[model samples]
Target: MNWKKPITSSLKSLSLSIALVCAGTYIAHAETVGEPEKEELKFGFIKLTDMAPIAIAYENGYFEDEGLYVTIEAQANWKVLLNGVIDGTLDGAHMLAGQPIAATMGYGTKAHIITPFSMDLNGNAITVSNDIWKKMKPNIPKMADGRPVHPIKADSLKPVIESLASEGKPFKMGMVFPVSTHNYELRYWLAAGGIHPGYYAPHKGDNSGQIDAQALLSVTPPPQMPSTMEAGTIHGYCVGEPWNQQAVFKGIGVPVVTDYEIWKNNPEKVFGITAAFAEKYPNTTIRLTRALIRAAKWLDDNSNANRPAAVKILSQSNYVGADYDVIANSMTGTFEYEKGDKRAVPDFNVFFRYNATYPYYSDAIWYLTQMRRWGQISDDKSDQWYKDLAAKVYRPDIYAKAAQSLIDDKLIPANEFPDFTKENGFKAPQQHFIDDIVYDGNQPNAYLEKFKLGLKKGDKL
Candidate 1:
C-alpha cells in the first residue's frame, strides 16, 4: 500500500508551509541528525474505529509531510500486531495502552515496549446479547418517555448472572486481548457494580482471570465480537467502536454503556515500539511521532470538521472494513444504544481534544493499578514502584521532544499541550469512574484499597 504516492502533492504544500516557518532551525537540526533514519515504514492496526488516527494520518498526507512513507496494515489480532512490532516486521503499531505496559512488565510477552502517543479516548462500550439486555432491562430505571436511562451500570446485570449461576451455567463475556484496555475497563465496570470480575493470578499458573469471578471474561478478536455474541458463545462483550455498533446494526445485541461512562476521558489506543527500536532509530521515532501528532491535531481541529471524511476513509475495505453507517454510528459524534435511539455524544470518539495526544504517566499508572488489582501484576508493590514502572514505559520525555519540534515549527500552539515547565507527567486526581471513586494517580496503592472486589495490598496470587 503506497500510502505516500496518493498524498504526495498535498504533502508538498505542507512541506512548504512547515519549511517557511522553521527553515533555519530545520537546517541546523538537519546538519546534526540528517534525514529520518527510516522513511518507508509498515504499521499495523486492528479493524476498530480507534485505529482511525492511523488511517487518517495516511490518507491526509501527515506521514508524507514528515519526509516518510507509511504502510498501514490490519492485523488478525492484537498478539500478531504486537509481535510484528517486537520482531521488526512492523515499524510500529496502534496498540492497547495496556499492551505496552503489560509487555514491559513481563505479564505475558516480555518486551521493552514504549508509547510516545495515545491514539484516542473513550471509544469503547459494553454490549449484551438481546436476551441478556431483555433480562437486565427490567431492573433499569426508565426516563419519563420510557427510554431506558443511559450510562447503564453493570448492577443491572447482576440478577442475570445470579439466575445463570443458579442454573449452573457460566456467564461468559468477551474482550479483545488479555492486556487490552477492553479487558481492564470491563473488569473495572463489573467490579464497581459489586460483581467480582476475577483476577489473573499468573504466579499460581492461572492466567484465565476466572479466579472468584461472577462473569467470566475471555479474549475474542475485535472483528468477531458481534458474531460470537450472536452465536451464543458469549452473552456480553466490551470492545472498541464499530463492533458494538455492528451488534446494533445486526440486531443481535445492544450496547448497554460506553467506557466514557465507565471512566471519563480514559486513554484507549497507543502507538507502540520496542525500546531497542526507539534507541536505534531515534530520528525515525520522532519523525513518526511528528506525523501522528499532525494527524491527531487534524482529527480534532475546527471542532472535528474533518471527522466525516475520516469516517469515509476508515470505512474503506482495507481499513476498518465495516459498513460506513456502522462506523459512523459512533465516529460522527453520535452513539446509538438501540435502533432509532441515537443521541448526541460529542466526545464519543476524541482524537486530539483534552490533550489526548499527550501520553500521561497517570494514564499509564491507572492501567497498571488495574493490572495489579486483577492479578496481572501477580504481586503487591509500593506506589513508587508503580510510578517508576510507568516512567520507564510511558515516555512523556520523548513526547515532549516531538511536541516541542511541532511547536517550534508552529504546527501546534503551546497552550494546547501541558505546561511542560511544571509538568511531572501525572494528571491531578480524577473523580469520574462509574463508581464515583476518586482516583489519585500518585497514590495508586491507596486507590487499589478502595476497590471491594479486586486484590488488595499484600495479597498474593
Candidate 2:
C-alpha cells in the first residue's frame, strides 16, 4: 500500500486548483518521508475534547494508513502526560500549548520538547460556581430578552471578589496546569477586569503563581474541575470541554465565558514529542504528523458535519469518557453557557480550519509573551531571543513536509494548508483579544508593551 491510500473524506474530491499557501520563515521540505522507522507507537492525552485529533486519527484508520500502529492512553493529568513523552513512555501526546515552550525554556521540566502539529483551537471556557454566578448575574448587563449579554467580562465578578476579600477570605480559582493555556487565559480574563491574578518568580523558586495576587489560581485535573468547585474548594476555573459543559449538566456551575470570548480563535492544545524522537526517527515523525493533519481536517470538513460522529467516539470509555450529551453539548458547533443559554459558536472546537494545525512561530511566541508577562520568565530579554526560542521549539519545517506529502497523494488539497512558499511563520497583526489589544508576532516586544497589567520591559518581580 502507498501513502496515497484513499481513506475516504468529504474533501477527497476537492480540486488541486484550490491551492496551499500561508507558511512561514523556517525549514522547507527536504524530501518526501520513507517508511516509518518506528512502526508501533503510543500517544498520551488528558481527558479533554481537544485531544480529539489523536482519537480521530486512531479511529479513522489514518494511523494504519501510514503503516503505523498507535496505542492511545489517557493520562492522570497534564504533568503525567508530559512526563510520559519525556521518558519515552509515549511517542507523542496531546499537550497544553505552553508545555513545549515552557519545557524547552526550562520553566518546570527541562527537556527539549517540540510540536510538529497543533491539535485544536478555542475549546476552553471559564466556569464559576452557581453561588458565584448568582452574585455575578446582577452585575452583568442583560439583553432585551432578559438573557445576560454574551462575552461576560470578569468585571462583573469584581464585586464578589471584593466582598470575599472584605471577609478576609481569598478568591481562589483553578487551572489545569501552571503552564497551561487555561492558566494564561484565566489570568488574562481576570486581569482584564482589574483583578490581579498574580505571578510566578521561578528564578526565586516561587512556582506558586500567587505572589501579590487578588485571585489565587491553582491546578486541578480537567475531570476534577466541577467536583472541586462544587465542594467549594475553588470559586471558579478555566478549563477545556467537555468539563465545562459537564458542570452545566450537573447543575453545579455556570460557564461564565468561553476562551473564544476571551480571545477569538486562540491556539489551544498541541501534539508534542521529544525533539530527540523527531531527529532519530524522522520518517515516523512525519508519518504521525500526516495522520493528525488528516484527522484535524476531517473534524472541520463540511461545516462540522462530522462532529456528531466524533462526539460519539469521544464519549467512549477509552477516550474523553464524558457522557455523550455532555460532550455533544459543545462538540456539535454550539456551546451552552447557562444551561438554557446555548448559542451557535461554529468555531468553538476548531480542528483544522483557519490553519489551526500549523505550528506557527507566532503562536509559540504568544505563550512566551504570557510567560514573561506573568513573571515566569522574570527577566528582560531581547525581541530576537523571543523569536529565536519560538523557532527552536515550533517545527513548522516538519509540518510543511507532512502537509506537502498529503497534497502530493491527493489525500488533501493544497489550499487546505498554509502556503509554505510565502508564509513567514508569524500571523499578521491579530486583534481578537477581549481587551482589544493587537498582537503582531513579528514584534513580540511591542505587543507585550500594549498590556498595562502584565510584565513588559523594565518591570521585574
Candidate 3:
C-alpha cells in the first residue's frame, strides 16, 4: 500500500547516501594517488639479490595495484642499467647507492638521477680466492670449534698483501663499480686494517684509484666476481650476493666479511630514476614508489616468511639467474662464509625493517663523504655542498608522499616509518663501522677528519 511507497523511497535515499560515501572514498584515493601517468614501464636491474624489491613489486602485483604494468630487465651491468635510465630505455633502475650521488655530482654520466627508495641494507661481502683464503686462514683467530671467528677483519689479509708485494706481485681486488657501495666498503675495510685501498685523483685524470695503494682495487661486475677471482684475475672481491654465496657453493673462495659487519645495516642499493622522469610523470613516480614500498614490506614481513618464495622468484632465469640454494644462502637470513660454516645473519638482506626503504639524506651524505674521501669529488666540499647534493639526489620528500599515502590507506602502520613530522632526513650518529669510526651525517667535513686513511680538510687528490 502507501507503506510500500515509503519503504521504496527510503531504500533509494539509502542507496544515494551509500553512493555519495563511495564517491567520497574514491575521490580521496584519487587524491592520494592519481592515475599513473605512464602505465607500461620498463625497469632495469643488475642480477643481484637486492633487486628483489623490483622483482617482488612486479611479481606480487603491487605495481598492478598502483595501475602500473612493469617490465623488469636484467641489464648487462650497472652502467648499462644507469644508461638505460638516462636514455629513457628504462624508466628506473635498481642502482648502487653511489650511482645517483656520483651522477648528480657529475663524477660519471652527468645526469640528474634521484632515488625515492633505498632498496636494502647490508647485502655485500668481501671474498678472497681459495689460495688467498688458505694463506689467510692461519692468520684468522679461530673459535674453540676451529671455526674462524665472526666478522673477520681485513687485518688477517694484510700480511698476505705485504708478502705478495715483497714478491713483486700487485695485490689486486675487484669491486662492482667505481662509485659502488662495494668499492667504498672494500676500501673502508682495507683502510681500517692499515692497508690502503688507493685513491682516485679524477682532477689529475687519474681515475684508476691506485695512487699509493697497498691493495689494488679495480672494477669487476658482480656476477663476474666469483669467476674473476677463481681465474686468479683478482685475489679478492667485494660484491653483493649471490656471487659471494656462489663462491661458497663452488668452493672457489671464502667470504671473509659482509658489509653488515663492515658497517652494520649500511645502506646499499636504491631505486633510481632520472630527475626529469620524476618531474614529467609525478604520478608514475609516486605510484612506483608506492609499489616498491609495498614490496619491501612484503619482503621483510612476518620475519621474512616470504623470503623462500622470493628466493625462488629470484632464482628464475629472467631474474637473478642463480640457483635457488645459492640465492637462499643469504636471502633467507643465514650467510655462508666458508664451506659448512653457515651462520645466521638475520639482517643480511633487510628490505623494509629499520625503515630501509626511506631515502634519507644521511644515507646520501654517507656516499658523498665516501666520494670525497676516495677522491671521486676530487676537492673539498662544504658541509652545505653535501646537504645540497644530498637533497638533490635522495628525494625523501617523494618517499614521504608515497609512505604516508600507504599509511592513510591503512596498508602499513605509522610506527613502521620514521616520523614524517619530525624527520630531518638525518639519521642519528651511526657508530657501527668496522673501524669504529663515528659518522655524523650532518657534519661531513668533521666526519672526514675522523678517518685516518681518507682525505681531510684542505686535502685534494
Model 3 CA lDDT for position 382: 90
Candidate 2 segments exceeding 4 Å error: 1-31
Candidate 3 residue lDDT tens string, 240-355: 99999999999899999999999999999999999999999998899889989989999999999999999999998888899999999999999999899999999999999998
- TM-score, every prediction: 0.94, 0.93, 0.93
Error of 1 at 374 (Å): 1.1
Q: Mark the 10 consecutive residues where model 1 has the least summed lDDT.
A: 25-34
What ranges in model 1 sit over 4 Å off?
A: 5-34
Cα lDDT of candidate 3 equals: 0.89
| lDDT, candidates in the order shown | 0.87, 0.89, 0.89
TM-score for candidate 1: 0.94
| Angstrom error at residue 437, model 1 | 0.4
| lDDT for each residue of candidate 1 in 1-461, tens digit (9 for 90 to 100) | 53664222244455665874576422113222236776788999998988888887777767766667788888999999999999999989999999999898888888999999999999999999999999999999999999999789889999899999999999999999888899999998898888899878788889999988899999999999999999999998999989999999999999999999999999999999999988988877887887788888888889888888888888888999899999888988899997778888889999888989889999999999999888888778999999999998998888888888878877788888888999998888999889999999999999999988888988886
* Candidates sorted on TM-score, descending: 1, 3, 2
Model 3 Cα shift for residue 361 (angstroms): 0.5
The residue ranges of model 3 lying beyond 4 angstroms of the native Cα positions read 1-31
- Superposed by TM-score, candidate 3 places the C-alpha of residue 376 at a distance from the truth, in angstroms, of 1.0
